[model samples]
Target: MTAAARYAALLQWLRSNDADISPKIDLQPSSRGGGYGAFLTEDAVEGELLFTIPRKTCITLADSIEDDACGEGFKALIETAGPGGNTVVMAGFMARERIRSLESQKPGSIVDDSSFGPYLATLPWERGMNNQEHVLYWDNKDIEKYLKGSMCYGEALDLRKEVDVAIRVLNTIVGKSIREFRGDYLDSGFQWPWEKAAQASEEKLKGPPEGLAEAVKGAFVCMLTRAFEDGDGDEEKLVPMLDMLQHSDEPNISHAMRKSDGAVEVRARQDLTAGQELLNQYRSELEETMPYHRFFTRFGFVPGIQEEMTNLFEDKSSIFFAQKAEI
Candidate 1:
């Protein structure tokens, strides 16, 4: 399906699941170059509601833990791996659902559908928006080449290692608990770095499908770039519709989890005009000002960051790279 079809499907899915989307707001190709963003279809005053996504429609750790297909595996993963593994479980569940969605599309496989298939289908990674890739998906060599001596580089390396560890641990857990995730589900969906490297090197390894690791990493990339705190607590969630808004230094909209109904609500921070692109502040400046390197490393791009701020780090990293090369 084309991008427009996917967006339409998403809207349909959202409404079917009790999500309240404002007809005044629409999702469209973003001018910010991040693939997609929300735009205003009608003029609105400050604090006007843009949308409200029911909490159940939001992908959260609790929902992952209770999933029918992989809940037991997730329970075991979290119990064995502790709190940090919660993120892994969420990503793994999403990956599994995504894999299921793909399988359903194959000939003679109509039963292999995911409950959250439409939302998963709209994710940037699933849409082949390579430019929207998070830093965690970048090759280790490329990360070192560009940012070796910078603080972001170290953080990136650490995050990569963490993902590697999660992959190994989750693989073992899935092998022991989840039957549905055993064979093809583990081996298909989402290309990983190793798969990319193998394709680049023209090397093919014949064996059991090892794509589970790839699937998890792919979901992690999506989670990293899109998920946000639900305002209920530190538990982050992937809220549909709200996540489609592009980031801007001066945001026009803000979101909060409604205490009354457990819905995620988006409201205009300032008066909005018809045809204006909706923008969100990914992080709160009042809480903390994110540095350029950290923002770039975390979200894969530093949208709205000053050119000089980014270039200063690039110049420093270039000097550091040259100095290390001399060694």
Candidate 2:
């Protein structure tokens, strides 16, 4: 589908989300920047809840093990992962779901879709205006060219290695087919959804590793850029359209997970204009909290924090790192 068409489908699915929770926002091509953004059609006051997503609605690794979707061994793996291994656990869950979606689409079952299919459909597996084109997928040359000498270069490299290891570990536990399926899926330029990928599997493509690569990378991206800390536990979870709102240095909306119901809510940080795009600043206003290179590599764009600020504090990060390491 075209970019607009894809966004249209996503918007339709999001709109059908609980009317009381979903905000009245327009998903249009961003003139302010690349990809689609959430724009308010009506003026909203500061401190007002723009949207709220019930915690249970979110698809998390907790759901994966509990729902019996993942195998017992995989469930044990998730338990072992805990807080530090959120990426591995979530990635496994997503990979598992993709396989289930494939099975459901087979001959006799022909099931419609999974509970998270709509949300899964919205994930950016292929290159698009607002899809998966993370540093994890970047060719090494691109990394060297764009990120060399930057703070995030090493971090990005390390991240890619981590994902590679995660994929391999899953391969050992699940099957080599997951990796093979991912290889073929990547070879196909990542355009295929579950049904398309499933058809390829039928054609002798690997099965267990179906969607493994994308799922792991996608989960990691979401974890780094969008996932939230859940109140019920230390587990990180994603809140649909809320996660889709792009970040800014000075955001107009502030989001937090409600302690009462484990629901997440995004409130206006300031009075917003009727047609303004909802900006959600990913980091705190504390200048030291967000290093420019980290932002660029993690979210795939520089915050354009300006040269003066960079000059002032750039040396400090290295100094701090050295001190912290006592090097």
Candidate 3:
């Protein structure tokens, strides 16, 4: 199918399954188009399972590249995903298939079936604007040298194919959620606190997706907001999945990757209360500046005196109390 047709089909599939598979989430839109959060429905006790999102559902840029030469030990890494392989493998296969088909009639062509030329040609240029800025691009001379040094003609061809398939798969599965809500105005049907913050701020407050600000320079707030807005709708869904855990400087819920299953799981490190807000420290206090600059700069909420007081007696006091009530 054509790329446009394939995209339509994917969107249809998401919309059809929306009711059955949609996690109990509340969409909170910010002044910026894509700023929102997802909250848990029922109060979850500590160590409770908030949710599980399969890696297949979320796509990343690395998933698209067919170039095994791009990284060392690439073949072994691809084989590790098992027999059917993961999306990365699929991407490689697809890239090869496209390259092969083109090469059949054009044997002398520099762009044969094993090449990533076709897949790269079809990449969504607009969506990649932000990513291009972050990544280091290879010049033709560098690429030619690397490709020659990395593998034989046949092996290079195979790697390019794999890269194509991976990129396609990543684009297909990751952005499903956000695409569904595009072009719609904010709705109260959802009850997200961040949305409330956006409303409270008269839609002026905007923040980056969790974790992004720390990972990328000048990527703190507005850049993330725009990236999500421009990203494949499916990829943007990942934000809500992460947001559902809520926010805590000292999070009871911890993010962990289960290597055995390749699934990212949120496990309770400590017991929790039903109404207690779930939180994961977006930036580590130990690693970053005091009071966590990311939180205050992005969320428009700061750790107040109450947080300081809690820190002072947090170890000894079972419950935190405000100074006004201490009298």
Candidate 4:
């Protein structure tokens, strides 16, 4: 299917998800023509409900484990990891399921195969738009060229280190459980893509599925860009339409936990005129306001970052070649 067709399918899926996406807002390809965006079709006032998704439909570890399409491998991870591995479990579930979707794609197949494929399609998959900005996904040259001397440069360095440790923990600790739990899941056909990519380096004998490292990145990316607490303290979950909203330094939506249904509900923060893009407050405050380097490293764009900083990326290849990346 074309990108337009896929977007339509995702909208169709969202409409059928036992929730009400307000007709006042329409989901369409963003004006930038990269990922989808939510736009207002009619004027909306503060406290108006834009949509209300059921708590059950939200993707969580419990949902992943309950679904058979996720396979027994992911369920095993959940049973073994307990609270310590929620991030890994979510990552593995998404990665394996995503690979299944990719492998299942045909020359003209109009459908996505994974259980959550429709929702997944709404997210940005390529490097630049969202994933490339974060330090975890940065190429070495881009780091020096675009990120160095910025406030986020150090964070990019730190997150790169975190990915390294997460990969190590996934391989040494989680991989052991995965291997022992459902050894078949790690077989050649189902194994992640990292090992093949990692073979060029001296780390081949390290016994980690090079894919696990990438999975950690995938999980972290999902967490960084989307996950919100389910109002049960720090339990983060990925909500469908809510995750698709573009980030804005100055937001127009008010987010709150719905007491009645347990859904993270959003209301119009102020009066919104028709045809405006619905912006979600991602990070604000002097300390929390996302710096350009961190924005590039995490979400792929920096909204209103300085022109001098982004100019550095023009001279270098934006594609990051993954190695055992260390700062």
TM-scores, all models, native as reference: 0.81, 0.73, 0.32, 0.70
In terms of TM-score, which candidate is stronger, 3 or 4? 4
Alpha-carbon lDDT of model 1:
0.72
Residue 198 accuracy (lDDT) in model 2: 70
Candidate 2 lDDT tens digits, 149-184: 656668889998998888766654445334333344
- Our model 4 lands, by Cα RMSD against the true structure, at 8.5
How far out, in Å, is residue 121 in model 4?
1.7
Question: What ordering of candidates by lDDT runs from best to worst?
Answer: 1, 2, 4, 3
Q: Model 1 over residues 1-327: C-alpha lDDT tens digits?
A: 887888889899999999988888788888776466788888999999888899888888988888765688789888887888888998877766776677778777645577788888788653237356466666767676667777677778888888887776565444322334334234346788998566424322322134666677778887887898865365878988788778877999888888887788889899989999988888754435466556776776765543433354567743223344554
- Candidate 3 C-alpha lDDT tens digits along 198-315: 6635422333222221222222121222212112232221222443233456766776544664445665567654334445665555654433223332332233322422233333
Question: Lowest summed lDDT over 10 consecutive residues: which window, candidate 4?
Answer: 315-324
Error of 3 at 237 (Å): 13
Which rank order by TM-score, best down to worst?
1, 2, 4, 3
The lDDT of each candidate is 0.72, 0.64, 0.35, 0.63
Number of backbone collisions per candidate = 2, 1, 24, 7
Clash pairs for candidate 1 = 186-212, 187-211
Model 2 weakest lDDT span, ten residues long: 304-313
lDDT winner between 3 and 4, please give it. 4
